[model samples]
Target: MTKAAAVLDYRAQARRRLPPFLFEYLDGGSYAEVTLRRNVAVLEQLALRQRVLTDVSAIDLTTTLFGAAQSLPVMLAPIGLAGMNARRGEVQAIRAANAAGIPFCLSTVSVCPLAEVAAAATAPFWFQLYMIRDRGLVRALLDEARQLGCSALVFTVDMPVPGARYRDYRSGLAGASGLGGTLRRFGQAMTHPEWALDVGVRGRPHHLGNVAPALGDKTGLEDFLGWMRTNFDSSVTWRDLDFIRSHWQGPLIIKGILDPADAREAARTGADGIVVSNHGGRQLDGVPATADALPAIVDAVGDALTVLADGGVRSGLDVVKLMALGAKGVLLGRAWAYALAANGEAGVAHVLRLIEAEMRVAMALCGRTRIADIDRSMLVSTAFQRQDSL
Candidate 1:
């Protein structure tokens, strides 16, 4: 964690520490990655309207979400294969989030089992579920989440089919099939001795934790990578909402919605909140940035539901920008993954400290003391890519 004061610093550390294939899988998006880059570049385009002499005083980053008050308005977004980044990586991340006074959402494909994370957690965390073909398994997982005291249920609905991640193919993480691909991946792992020791070697039986019951001990890393394509249920529709609502009486947040129409539909489903995301620019390549889509979605939904967002959020200032665009909170995906890969729990804790420090600077310099003071009035407008405006 030396000299790693920012999210990009941690990203550099993670790239250097991880194998080529693991780094590429965590860093790259589908196809040309146009929207992936846009997620960051467009957010940077929105200028902060700085102010002066408002009695240069204190700043507050505290906020309430799903009836729980937290120190910051940031949550760790669900990332598949994140556990491969470090030993019990999700456990480390949740620990960091707990210490930071924020919530951590565990991915259904996490490296650590739900029981393990539940035992380690001092506070309640969120659980994210994908639309898989196995309804019985989904219901069972929901029951498990309830028994474990999950504060919210995040239903990710965008990925009926996994995206065409060309980078993964090039790096031998995906399309490289058969014995030759496995050999190539093994070679890459051997090259990164540090990562090989920490995660690959010591992280034995390194398969998806929550899915182990369903997968039973038959799959390897290669099979794990391709499991989503076959298991995801494209036949799912809004009528299936009751299936989740019936099991989870907690705050149900529907993630991966980018359109106002979809946002409105989510609001009508009696959901507690909706996340305006483009699947971290992973599912589609040319869709509008999450920042670009958030304002209109927020306008369409209004107070109908709590609006959260993810994608291209790299810093505390970026979090402020998303909030100004009307997001109740922002999720950190690659940012936290990089941190976790770089230095495990300490790295994540440091990144949260960085976010807190940066957010305070941004809020105070803009003459905003409270989280509610951050609204659209603080932004200098630009010609947005999304044409629909509220």
Candidate 2:
């Protein structure tokens, strides 16, 4: 099959494999999905110039970040409740990422525990931290991640409150909150027998694994969500980040910075890197795409910190566009989740292979022999009214 056909085939397979609810959770975003669609749409508007002649053979995609070298500029974005998409979803994705020679960031809300994921993956992966109200609990989790040899600490700054995901609401996932929430969730789980037998029947899904200890053996989903809602420190600030930085001496990456000023602040706050993101357009409905905001953030830091970009990154061409726009690397979120939902480890591997191939082809066509050579000059924004077209 052709490369584009392969991706389409994967999408078709993924839809058939995953239940409607699980699929929507991976595919949907905040209210109306306005920003989510806009995110990809805006990126698609930019054009890449195709060059006629260049010695494109010997292309090198190797790159460095936080003193570590990676085979590609793509990293898996931290995703929550990944197991719902597939059995042992976190580890499966990690294994695929490790094989592909890329970093995988485990979410604070992963179904698998930090130690479990760490134990399963061959390489050191980054751990994403969602600072909770309980300082002691936060400290303990960070300490655990550090002990597990996490390469970096990614502190997500947005999402003080959960965004109103219309899809989740429509799926009745939101209303499935109560003492029997676990049972209700299980009922929904019945719809996806594959996920049920793989992750549910074989393994239990509960609160954020790292923070579950604080909840004292609670197994109810409502209780878990309650604790999470009450505990997610809404007043988190740069001062709080400093507190984290003081405790963790390793590379500190501040995630969820879309504003240029915020990126400047991240650099000023002693962060080693900053992920330019809008939380995959899951947090807010009208935020600009990460690509549109990336150049400014890179310019603001004055090359002081590594700048990575996320949100609406679907293909290798998207990765190239991000790099040309000044992002040192790109993060994949829903794309990998789709793969996980479709075919587990093999599916994720397919996505990695697909994107890498696409990136290579895009690079060759744009007269950029190497990933490092992709630049802003390769693109042109098509002048059109996006909303009307959509």
Candidate 3:
């Protein structure tokens, strides 16, 4: 109502507010980005039929996942280095997600440690595990999440190798090469003065707190960078899920799944849920879009497991589209990240409100009074329908 009017409007504003390096990191996809574009394009193409005069007054947006009830059917996708976007960044995001009555997944690479974020968050949040090569360290981190009362451990399994984001290369922001890398990033920070004054000057020291203790007493950005390269376990396999299961005793979500076979495997491996994601189309350039892959994954596992989808979910209509295709819940990645970069906690809260409002309106237009009332009949495949017409 405040004239930002739509979720995409906030995205545009966020692009202007954030530095190019940070913005590109959040917005860009894998090489060529075909799947990235497809994710959104496919959702946009899904046309829903509106039914008139159908008692849409008592619209109910609430839904539950893994036994916990949500105010809406959306969740905040985990994004690393959120602290770089706002002061005590992850905490701000957690506060916003709590206010919205949704779960906030804490990334393994978060700038603030698990304990501090847990202390600030009023409700239980999910913890995302990266499966670091240091098995002992991974165990320690799991213990930390357990002690902090995390509700679930979301294991990200897609990035066996890091995706090549050309934007990072163009910006030269990896902090890889010596003092030159340092100076370049410094200039990037200087370009965004407000971000610098707020997140940079007043923010908590930007270290990966969970793993910092394992790296010993060396407590600067350089040491943190070195620790990251040494720790991330690129060789992780399905068997590694066993190691994770042994340590955590709550609902387990295996993220970054695309193939139906992998989805079934996730269920066999005891995952309570599987996220149909291509790492938001950031991991594999040629992988199928989450929307395209979701139905198959859901069909493969059926009622055996919970199905969640992420990547290119920009609107409430998109949420409805995924649900009709067979997703119980959807995760918002770059959308909310843009909101966080735009105005911290308040900006993210605004986005939650905006998306919730859109969902309510979209549901009413589709003749659905509640989220559960939406079904596959509301959607028609363009290809199948056109073939029938022919």
Candidate 4:
């Protein structure tokens, strides 16, 4: 594999390495993808106020999140089916993240079970939960996480129901195996022989590990999808937090908050943190970008809880942008996923190195020596000025 100098390069390599069905599943957003495009567009519009001549010799990227020290203010956001990206992909990404001195969040739908990742990981990884209908199952999952020594619980609230990602249907990603619709998928897989060997052949335990025990006899991808569609509780409310809090005493973070009222409500639930995300623009098509919504949410609840943001974060400059907009840290989803798909664990480690280097340069140019020093003052925008007052 060739060296990937940037996130886009890794994305291109991932596109080449992964089958169309898998790549689109990782890349596409919901419906018209208006919010998906807006997420990047809004971030691109924010101008950084650069400064020079100040002493930027000692740049500090260290920060504390959920009472834990980290080298960077970024965490690897949970990506489902990561193991399908490579042989035991979640484990590979976790290893890379731990080596990079950052946190890796394992999704409930990950191919590698929590136990597998926990055993392989040098450090405790965070766990992300998608609320299901069965309260018993939710409790069991929380218990498993606690047993695995997971320090944080990221409860994703936006996905009561899965979004309508047209790409999945178009690519035959949701089609049952041995069906005529999957012919194109098979052909695409054939084109990527390395992925076929690494993920398709070598990647055993391809089923959703965390939820498998509850699934009983139904274990295939199609069955899992059916189970997820049926089990994701659309009726989940603020009351549900009480149930979760009862089971897990660790740091609980509400992941899909974009509104100030919602942020305040999450804080009321005694959540340790709130991630200002629009579900990577995969849930609602018209919702505001994470960047646009982050400042207000931060202003409303920053004092009560730690504020984080995720959406269209592709580079270290983007990470600095989020901090300047009042985010305590940022979560990365597709960026690391692209790296994992492109070159497995090595690609992820390389991407993290690139991001760290880029962030150091960005911080130096912005005249900020530390992560906490970045604020609205480093950004130049009329809208940001108004948000600063908030």
Candidate 5:
């Protein structure tokens, strides 16, 4: 197909390039996906305020996040099994992000190990961690990140219990699929020779690199899900933050926060930042979209810690919209994954340029030349309205 001109274009291309199961995993949200739809719909409602005459000549999209300079106020959010989207996919994506002057957060469940990503990096990137029941394993992973030169640690607290992602079950990504599921997936792979050759064949040893040692002999994707189901620390509480703080000596970001109370608690825990997210609408089905939840949370702790937001971000306008809502930066999830699946490092690179270019035009039109100048003022008054006020 012709080159993807926009972020959503890559999504369409990815659907054609990836196997059905993988595409569904990248595309689908939890349960009925009500919150998923709301995430985009609410952001779309906040229109930008435009001006004509103010010097719209120079647009500055550069900003600093977690002590590192970024070309755009956007980041590549961690996606588990993102490497399966292309050959050494996470590596390709990070390289692309690094080239574009943005940070890429590596997932704990990534197909490529941290060491592999670090080996390919010219600039330091961030790392995301889940609180598994095995503290020893968690500590080991932290030590690995320290040694690998990861600049930040994104501690995700949203997934104490995995959500019932109906798409995963239907795609056989979750639950016991048995022999029938295996055969069906195999057939799907056969139909998509491109993904099969690049990822299935060339991308050898598809085990989740970070947790492979604990797998012992159980090395299949199903075993990875099984390990996740069993090891996710459902009993975790705020006390666990102290434990994590003791080990990691970098920027500590608490992600998956949606409430003002939770944001305050995260700041109290001494987190460097917090991501206002509903886990990309992949965790709970009915929670308010990140856009809806951001205002109150930012009001509560915007000064105490950096407030980032992510959910249904598909373009530079979405990035600008989140910043206007008071997010320090926006984390791109499916957008980058789609680019990686559709092409590779190049696709990701191209899509990032599109976002940066779009942000430039949007900022120019809104009379905001710099990233810092982008605030609720740049958005129409609709952003100031609360749901109950409506």
Candidate 6:
């Protein structure tokens, strides 16, 4: 793990450690992955303005998110099937996030249930919800999150239906059935003996822990996929948000707001925050990159809501870039997922440390001493003006 020097290094290690199916599920985006590539490419194009002589001696990265203090302007984004990446992967990631003084958002379909993760964690974490067709199940899940003392509720609205990720089909990850598909998946798993021994063998609770009762008896990957196909409510609209608001009295964050109009609507819903995301480019292809979509969303609702962005945020400078564009903070998905898959909890901690270090260097170079001071001034006019105006 010490040899895993960077986030990309952890990604490489995860590729080696996990089976092709699980690795592709984590790494690949939907369809042609045009939006996926655009997310990172657009962020990379944004040049930072460096300042030579400025008093950046005491850099402060501390930020207050939804009234709670965070060591950095980052949180671990909710990722489904995190446990498949490593043994007790969600619990490990939550613990790592707690130790780092950041928030960890548990997915509705997380392998570890909210109570189990709450028991394992040192502090309260956030819970992410997916609107399913079953209202009873949704209410139960929200109650469970409240009972577990979750600090916030992140309602993900982008996934009316799962994206058509071609890699999942190619890698035999999309609940492949029958003799040939099963054999191919088995062969891929057999190739990664380490993952088989650790996650497959030792990590016994492989199914979705949160919705186990609703799913009842059907615990295999195929069953889970079948359940998702039928359960996700495509008819879910903004009216459904009133139901969520009526049930949960905590800080509500609307994730997957790619449009300024949607951002305004999210603000109107009384959401405390809105994550400017394209579901990490996994939901809608050919859409604007999250980086491209962020400035407009922020401009629409920055004053009314705590605007956050996620998608292709692989480095600390990327974090700073989103912040400069009026995002109060950022959420990390693949970076932490890759780290967790590579070296379990410690790998997550290492990734956080690296990100904090990178952020500090970037802040100093940009002549910003505090996280709040990092605004459009830190960005080159060519990038900031061009993108923000769009």
- For each candidate in turn, the TM-score is 0.96, 0.93, 0.93, 0.95, 0.96, 0.96
Query: Which scores greater on TM-score, model 2 or model 6?
Result: 6
Tens digits of per-residue lDDT, candidate 6, 1-390, equal: 221248889999999999998899899999999898888888878889999888989999999999999999999999999999989899999999999999999999999888889999998899999998999999999998998899999999999999998998888877587667668877988899999999988998888999898789888776787799899999999999999998899999999998899989988878899888998879888999888888788877758989988998889989999999888989999999999999999999999998998999999998999987989888886745476532
Report the lDDT tens digits of candidate 2 across residue range 164-212.
7888666656656664544656677787677667766675664557777
Clashes of each: 0, 0, 0, 0, 0, 0
lDDT by residue (117-183, candidate 3, tens digit) is 9999999999998878888888998999998999988899887667776766676655445677677
Runs in model 5 with CA error above 4 Å? Answer: 1-5, 382-390
Between prediction 3 and prediction 4, which has the larger lDDT? Answer: 4
Error of 3 at 163 (Å): 0.9
In terms of TM-score, how similar is model 2 to the real structure? 0.93
lDDT of each: 0.88, 0.81, 0.82, 0.88, 0.88, 0.90
Q: Which scores better on lDDT, 4 or 6?
A: 6
For candidate 2, which ten residues in a row score worst on lDDT? Answer: 381-390
lDDT per residue (tens digit) for residues 314-389 in model 1: 8888999999999999998998899899999998888888888888888988989999889999887656523322
Model 6 off-target regions past 4 Å? Answer: 1-5, 178-180, 383-390
Candidate 5 residue lDDT tens string, 1-390: 222246678888888888888898889889999888888788777788998889979888889988888888889999999988999999999999999999999999999999999999999999999999889999999999999899999999999998888888887767646687677778888899989998999998898899888887777777888888899999999999889989998999999998899999999989999999998889999999888899899999858999999998877888999999899999999888898998999989988888887888899988889999989888776534454221
Q: What is the lDDT of candidate 4?
A: 0.88
Model 3: worst 10 consecutive residues (lDDT sum)? 381-390
